[model samples]
Target: MTITFRRMTPDDASAVTAFLTANRFPFHVNPAPCESSANKRVAEGHFWSKESQGYWVQHGGKDIGLAVLEDLEDDNPVFDLRLAESHRGRGLGVDVVRALCRLAFTELPQIVRFEGQTREDNIAMRKTFLRAGFVKEAHYRQAWPTADGTRLASVAYAILRSDWENNTVTPLEFDDLLLDA
Candidate 1:
């Protein structure tokens, strides 16, 4: 169950293109993506930029997923993760997320927190966030738009660097809306 992360490079274009095209990420607004589009996006460095970097989620010496970590300059960095279709539903999300947390907390020393978001309908991902020690920070209604123009609520989660290092969960205070009599 060895899991590792590899920084993606231009040489990985074909492999990334194939991996993204072959899988259907139903939880995303655009579940089915065309191969050519995927290739073009990868070639265009959609995932790799000055503010962001993409990585290959390798398990047991094989690439099984992709993770794009963004918002590098901010105190809070976020990530987008997608596992291969065959690798989904096998309890790998938590492991991958934990690895992401390690990369964020260690590689980016200035970051105070690491964040991730998923559609409200994506219960699996939400659970994975919880399992990986991310606290539910927000739920924005009608925030995530779909391919057909419909919208779903977007749920946000985060893990503090302190919490990650200490192996603790520091719950957010959500009672700010209480009205005084």
Candidate 2:
């Protein structure tokens, strides 16, 4: 299965709405998004904006998911990746992360690092981040709000441009600084 990323435009609003409403993203802030809400989000430039850009995650020429790269004007850009229900456990996330890194680092020269955050319970995504060479940088407690009025720890992972270029994983020295209580 050949994975590819296609840039999304305003004309693709309907497609984006359909994709969002058709799939259930349990890990996302809004899991089962309503059609009207999806339409509203699309209309409000949630996908395509000055600070954000969207892309279609295609496999074998078919649209399988969506990847929205946010904070484009910033040095560290983050992405939100969602795959179709049928394509979730098929090991497509690593490829999606790679594609996002390629798109950000290769296309945007100003980006110093590429980051992504997922709920603490999202084990698959955490593993995907590790596999994609992203080091765990932060874990904000109760940062991810779910649809069920509950919150989960938001685990952030990032990869520097130097690491990406050298094809290496720069391990974080979390234990370097020790403070006396």
Candidate 3:
């Protein structure tokens, strides 16, 4: 399935919360912060750094997932993305992330690099990030705190504008880098 991201609205709070509640993330369990909480945190406020813009993914006109991103204290972009169970594993993850990165780089003037973090055991996510040109940069032992207070190892990945630009600029006729079914 093909997916795309659209701007998020305060009205999307319920849907975002519902998606998070029904989804099972390996190292996370906090319910989507209360609607009012997310609304307030994601909403514009002087204390909250900067508000995030969320995009609900759609495939063939049906909502299938969400991707949320924002700039934080160090002028770095942080993001979270999820694909519905039925939408995972057919290569849609890379497509969604690319779209998000493109939008982020285009709209955010100060952003030169974009970053994301995921549990080390999340192989699929790591692969998707790599294939989309993000290089795994750091590994933190037991960084992901679980519901039981157990911590899971976490890894962070990043891609800079120059990295993506240089890689894509090279014109290679051979298809070694291409994915095949």
Best by TM-score: 2
Residue 10 displacement in candidate 3 (angstroms): 1.0
| Candidate 1 RMSD to the real structure | 1.3
Tens digit of lDDT per residue, candidate 1, span 1-181?
9779999988888888888888999888778879888988887786788778999999989888999999887989899899999888998999999999999899999999999999998999999999999999999999999988899999999999999999999999987789889
Question: How high is the lDDT of residue 173 in model 1?
Answer: 93
> For residues 12-78, what per-residue lDDT tens digits would candidate 3 score against the true structure?
6666666655665554434234555544544453122345667788878888877778554445788
For 1-181, candidate 2 gives per-residue lDDT tens digits of 7678899999999999999999999999999999999999899887899899999999989988999999988999999999999988988889888888988898899999999999999999999999999999999999999998988999999999999999999889988889999
RMSD value for candidate 2: 1.0
Candidate 1 residue-wise lDDT at 147: 84
Q: Against the true structure, what is each candidate's TM-score?
A: 0.95, 0.96, 0.76
Root-mean-square deviation per candidate = 1.3, 1.0, 8.2
Candidate 2, lDDT over the whole model: 0.92
Please give the lDDT score at residue 149 for candidate 1.
89
Best by lDDT: 2
